[model samples]
Target chain A: MGEKIKVDRVTKTFVVRDSDQKGARKEFTAISNMEFSVKEGEFLTIVGPSGCGKSTLLDLLGGLSTPTKGRILLDGQEIKGPGLDRGTVFQQYALFPWKTARGNIEFGLEAKGIPKREWRAQSDHYLELVGLKSFADRYPHELSGGMKQRVAIARSLAFNPDVLLMDEPFAALDAQTRETLQSELLRIWEKTKKTIIFITHGIDEAVYLGQRVVILSANPGRIKKIVEIPLKHRLADADIRSNPEFVKARHQVWSLLHEDEYAGLYI
Target chain B: MVAISKQVKSAKRLHKLTINPLLALQKLVKQSIVLLLFFVVWEIAPRIGLVDPAFFPAFSEVASAWWNMLLSNELFSHFSASITRSIAGFGLAIAIAIPLGLVIGWYPIARDLLNPILELFRNTAALALLPVFILLLGIGETSKIAIVFFACTWPILLNTIAAVRNVDPLLIKSARSMNISSFSLFYKVILPASIPTMFTGIRMAGTGAILVLIAAEMVGAKEGLGYFITYSQYNFMIPEMYAGILTISILGLIINYGLLALEKRLSRWKQDPTV
Candidate 1:
């Protein structure tokens, strides 16, 4: 498979005013010399400790912010700014409070100038895909945390983007709801075959969903290691977590992440 | 099966009790009783000579004066005149303030340039400028309308600026990641998100408009409810004066309710019916 997204020696630095010392500026390196690539149609999960700049890296990939050095390429083209080719799902479930579930999903479609007649069908398809067909009319406030996240996922998917950048999308959900949504996500991924770059701090989640898990360390976050999961069957199948192979793969990711001094701070 | 059937039946009964029409009627009747008692005391106190009749006219006396003015259509003309001036001034304020607020809020440079001037004018009560407005615009409708406009503009303008500036950063980040155009990002995300705050300013401005307009009318005009009250007072027409004062209070109430209804209709999403 061809490389769909490539980060080549990217570095990001932020200049913040020192609150304690007046007129003094401090430079903080969020990430330094980060390099990775996602092949077409690959599910890549990035795991790291808190303050690791995992989110900053995702921001770079999503084209929400530019790197201080190096460049990110999509299909060999340098990414300059945010574009509709990549859709993002936030952990906060940033669905517009003013919009109903279907209206939120149709936001991108409306931005693309899709014919008004086609909006309902396109939104309905993704709502059903996320198992929220009955909740199309509900506002975000009316929906539960899990349901809101599902609507957010469906919203990003409905826009028919080539890449999905999900930032801890299910981290706020309850354990059972998180597991159910993880399987649903895998189902959606299989059906759409869209390349997904998922960010999380959960080792088991990183292993369960990713074909390749990119582990990042804190303190000017850089890739610590990249572990490849060698599951022989679909991850969404029940009892896969009980399989010896799944347990072993999960342990490999956990050990790599735990070796870092900052690992205990997050998980 | 029997337990499941019993649970469903109980749920239906609970829903019925919560939404019962009779319960709603009872609440309304309970509210009206207090108002009726207030009117009863007001009518009896003056009749029984508990207070001087000239100063504390009977409720029936005010009612008959109101009815007489209504029959003569004198009340209608005064009412419509006040309504027209207030509406014109308030509507103009909305048109000017909302756009200015949105622009100033969105652009830091604009905010920096305008904020001091806004603060200065907002702090200076609009009523205090009555003489100056009359001097510049003359004691005509223009001066009255201008003062009302001045009073109504600040709340809306300032609130709009605050609302636009305070939108959640996460919402903006999510919208940006979609690669939506700048215009779409603003109208779709920023505008709707800022609406609740914007409405807050508008409601305040609505009240301000009525208050300022009535005060301005009392000072200069010969038509509005404010003028009617002063005219009746000088003539010692106590009942007519009270009628005019009552009209102002009623007008204020109606304006507040109307704005509230509009706010409620537009912000249906903010309401949590579950609570």
Candidate 2:
């Protein structure tokens, strides 16, 4: 498979006002010289301690923010700004409160320049894909946290982006809901066949979802190690998370994160 | 059987919600029993001389005075005149304030240039500047409308700025990733997000429009509820004065509910109303 995305020596830094010294500025590197590549149709899950720039990396991939020192490429083309080629599902769901579940889905199609007539069918198709066909007319506030996130996923997928960028999409949900969504997301990803980049703080989630887990350490985040999860079965099976291989992969990612010892403080 | 009946009861409630809002109003009317009792006390108090009839006329007397003015077409003329001025001033304030507020809120340059001036004028009460409006615009329809216009501007402007500024950042980020245009971003996301807060300002400005217009009219005017009430008070037509005051109270309520209804319509997706 060809490289779907390449994070080539990318480093993101911010010039924040120095707290101790008045009027002085200091450079804080969120991520330093991060280099990685994702193959076509690969499920890449990134895990890190807090402030390890996992989110900053996602923002760079989504083209919402620019890397301070290096460039990110999608299909070998430099990403200048956010476009329909990539779909993003945020942790907050970020569903338009004024739009219905279907309306939110239709908004993506509209942004993709799909005609008004095809919107209903296309949106309904994606809504069904996320098992939210019944909630087509329901508004964001009327939905549970899980349902809202499902609608967010439906809206993102409805746009038919080649790559799915999810930034801890299930982090806000309850334990049961989060587990359920994780399974559903995997199902959706398999069916859609999109290159997926999932960012999470959970060790089990990273190990379970990713074909390869990119473990990042904090304080100028650099990749500690990338653990490959060789699961016996791949799909939405809750039992798979408890499998021996799954447990082993999860353990590997956990220790990699804890390598710096500061991971315990954050945890 | 008990479970079946409970489901039926909920089904009936659902039917009322979808089909007949009048059935819903039954709940509201039942809650208004205290208001009904207040009217009853008001009717009997003056009749028994618990309150002076010359000053605080019986509820029946006020009703009769309201009826007579209605019969003479005097009520309609004054009502129309007051409504026209209120609508004109209120409409003009919204037309001006909402757009300006969006610009001021969305753009730092506009906010920086106009914020100090806004803070200065916003502090000076519209009622305090009634004389200035009357002095400059003269004691005419222009002054009455101008005073209302002045009073209505601040709330709508401030609220709109707040609405524009406070849109959820994550929502914007999510939309931008969809490759939405800047124009579509404002229309599709920011404007709708701001509607709830802007309506709050509009509702406040609605109250301000009536309050300041009445005051402005009371100072010098010929045909408003304020004028009618003051005129009747001076002529010792105590029932008529009370009737005019009653009309103002009703008008205030109607305007408030009207705005509420509007907010509900615009923000149909808003389950919990902040207002």
Report the C-alpha lDDT of model 1 over A1-267, residue by residue, as the tens digit: 889999999999999898889999999899999999999999999998887898899899899999999999999999999988898999999989999999999987886678999999999999989877877898887677778898999988888889999999989988877887888889899999999999998988998999999999888888989989998666545878988888999999889888856556765
**Model 2, span B1-275: residue lDDT tens:** 23324433543453364547887698688899889999999999999999998899999989999999989999888888888899899999999999999989889899999989999999999999998998999998999988888899999999999999999998888889988888999989999999999999999999998998888888899889888888988999899999898888888999999999988899888876442
Error of 2 at B56 (Å): 0.5
Q: How large is the interface RMSD of each prediction?
A: 6.1, 6.5
Q: Pull out the clashing pairs in model 2.
A: none
Per-candidate DockQ values are 0.46, 0.52
> What is the DockQ (computed on Cα atoms) for candidate 2?
0.52
lDDT scores in order:
0.90, 0.88
Q: Give per-model TM-scores.
A: 0.94, 0.94
How do the residues B1-275 of candidate 1 rate in per-residue lDDT, one tens digit apiece?
23324433543453364567988899899989999999999999999999899998999999999999999999999999899999999999999999999999999999999999999999999999999999999988999899999999999999999999999999999889888878888888989999899999999999999999989999999798988989999999999999998888899999999998998888988954555
List residue ranges in candidate 2 displaced over 4 A: A236-238, B1-26, B273-275
Backbone clash count for every predicted candidate, in the order shown? 0, 0
